[model samples]
Target: MTANKIELRSVNVTRYITPLREGGSLPALAEADDDFKYVLKFKGAGHGVKALIAELLGGEIARTLGLKVPELVFARLDEAFGRSEGDEEIQDLLKGSQGLNLALHFLSGALTFDPVVTQVDPTLASKIVWLDAYTTNIDRTVKNTNMLIWHKELWLIDHGATFYFHHAWDNWEKAAMSPFPYVKDHVLLPQAALVEEINDEMIALLPDEKLREITNLIPAEWLSWEGTNTNADAIREVYFQFLVQRRNNANNFVKQIQHARETLV
Candidate 1:
């Protein structure tokens, strides 16, 4: 997690026009800038604070885990667009604040698989499964691969579903325990050589100071303050715990892959 000096840039809302995706609430577009293209979402969709927090924080976590995801930034609009601009209909649909958007790097590659019919590379799938396990990510399934292929490389996106159970932490005592069933069939489970290679690379890249700093990048407005000043610290702690768990589990999974490969050979 080497903290790359991320310069927060204010986006010019009017310069680029985004087309709305079918069944997608936010307006999205492929950008002209090669360094960052794809403004996939804008703020008018009325999802609550918790959902926003999950997206922002989960993006950071994915970066820390050495997963290839699009660069994310907080964006603002000068004014709300009128009914003709798509705001009128969304206004009726959402309850919270409006007039802002979150920009994510637009993935240029093709979707590798439909959640139900496609298969992922074994090593990549294992890493994703390990990450989901640590973060309690509920959304990465056969239905929403959130996985992509570009230039023969795999990329992950749409982490809005991780830590969905976080708010229910107190109910852990009665929590129904079940293992992630899909782990057994994940494509990455069979790629022992690749998993070992990735494990070493990811571990080497994740630096402690960088991880701490990345946590601070999460927007405070996305959190539940409720007059409590500890919100920031608490959120950071949760992120840290997830990182630790992810590292540990990833290490074990890598070993499992290696052992299995050896046995097969």
Candidate 2:
């Protein structure tokens, strides 16, 4: 995860436009004080701030791998911004999310990626597959690719579903090297014949310090979950250790993918 860092911007939500209903978390289209539109996902969503943490890390990982990811920002929610909304549920979400939440710069007119209509390059496909495998992202199935096509380029999005195993931290380390069965259903698996190459590159690029910096980018308040007793800094160290171990033992995950590829064939 070594790349020119995009300084995370913080902007206050100036207006609530509309809800993007397709997203289960009720992410909304909103205009920010910075004069940019962003699809803001609330910190108070049912999935909790862990999802936002995953989004930040996953998007940064994709960017380091030379994949296109929209600029990520912390969308500052004013407690009163959504008070006037007609939908009480959405209003509740907004009010609960006051302070800071995760958001991505909105790409106007970008179309959802349709696997049936688009054929990605095998190498690029391999890199995407490798990324999802490493992060344990569960959202990039054929039913929901979580990608977009803008300006004739593939853009990765909606990585909030990543690092799912973090939800059950009791056995997080034991599960670090565990097989990723979901890779079989990955929409791009059939085209990801060169994943090992990507894996090698990512392993070399994602040094401990680089990954530490990525985790540091996460807001401390976001890391302090309800059920966790550890402070934010300790939790961040946990993420770093998990990532470093996974980086070292990525071969186990890569092997799982290769075996599944054989079955798919």
Candidate 3:
């Protein structure tokens, strides 16, 4: 619960349950050695390790801001783990992802968030909107809120779609200061009446040190690729710099959120 230090627990995958076909990454409901079920995200998915990096950074940033996010863990898949799988596709996926992957503690009996039935207060709505905009998360739209209701509380999930700029990795500086036009489509935009009021408070939560802390969570294996010239340390620094610049220019996205909310309401 310390603000400065954040760590993700590691768990070895003990059994592969059925895949959650809804996720593009072919995430599965797998049991870990800890005897807990997790929604395992594979490193061999279409988005590759970048998606895992985004998920880790974004989810941890949300946690740093005092938001409710599922506990993320490093789900290890051994080389021989999935060789016996009957499904060819799954077997190939497991073969390719024979290393550290990301998983979230599975919340049983959790319901997908529906804006129609559930009402969020203006401040909470503002915080979530701020988080999505700051992270450049395009997944929290009306169609896929990416939120879960458990124990009568809202929990954020599926942050793999955030930090999309990293897919290209060249225009990150421009992206840092860019206005998130997608904020208009956020499911909670209409309820985010207090964006301006809570803007400074939320901004203060993410300092340069905090950004570095979150980006440092990305594993070295996740950063290396065949063609990329950048090393893992350099890549981590880029992520940190992007977040620091974005945090420094919070006004840009904050204004975008206010404008979008004005149009929505």
CA lDDT of 77 in candidate 1? 45
Clashes of 1: 9
State how far residue 56 of model 1 sits from its true place (Å).
2.9
Give the alpha carbon lDDT tens digit for every residue of 1-265 in model 2: 2366557889998999999997679888999998999999898787878889999999998887789999999888876788789998988888788888989999999999999999999899998998898888988999999999999999999999898878887778976787788888999999998988777787877888778888889888787678768998988888888788888899988998899899984
Task: Score candidate 2 by lDDT.
Answer: 0.87
Residues 1-265, model 3: lDDT tens digits: 3365897899999999898987568889999999999999999998999999999998999998889999999999988898789999889899999989999999999999999999999989999999999999999988999999999999999999999998888878999999999999999999999998998999889877788888889999998976888899999999999888888888999999988877863
Off by over 4 Å in 1: 1-9, 15-27, 30-37, 42-47, 92-100, 108-121, 169-204, 224-230, 245-265
Global Cα lDDT for candidate 1: 0.55
Q: Report each candidate's C-alpha RMSD, comma-separated, in the order given.
A: 5.5, 1.4, 1.3
Candidate 2 residue spans exceeding 4 A from truth: none
Model 3, position 24: C-alpha lDDT score: 69
For model 1, how does the per-residue alpha-carbon lDDT over 1-265 read when each residue is reduced to its tens digit? Answer: 2356544354444434555553355545634334456554544453444555567667776776767877776655444433345555544422234444567766665666554454566666656665664455666555556677766667776666665655554433222232333344343444424655566666655556655666666666555555445676776676655555555455554454455445543
- Model 3 / residue 186 / CA error / Å: 0.4
How accurate locally is residue 261 in candidate 1, as Cα lDDT from 0 to 100? 49
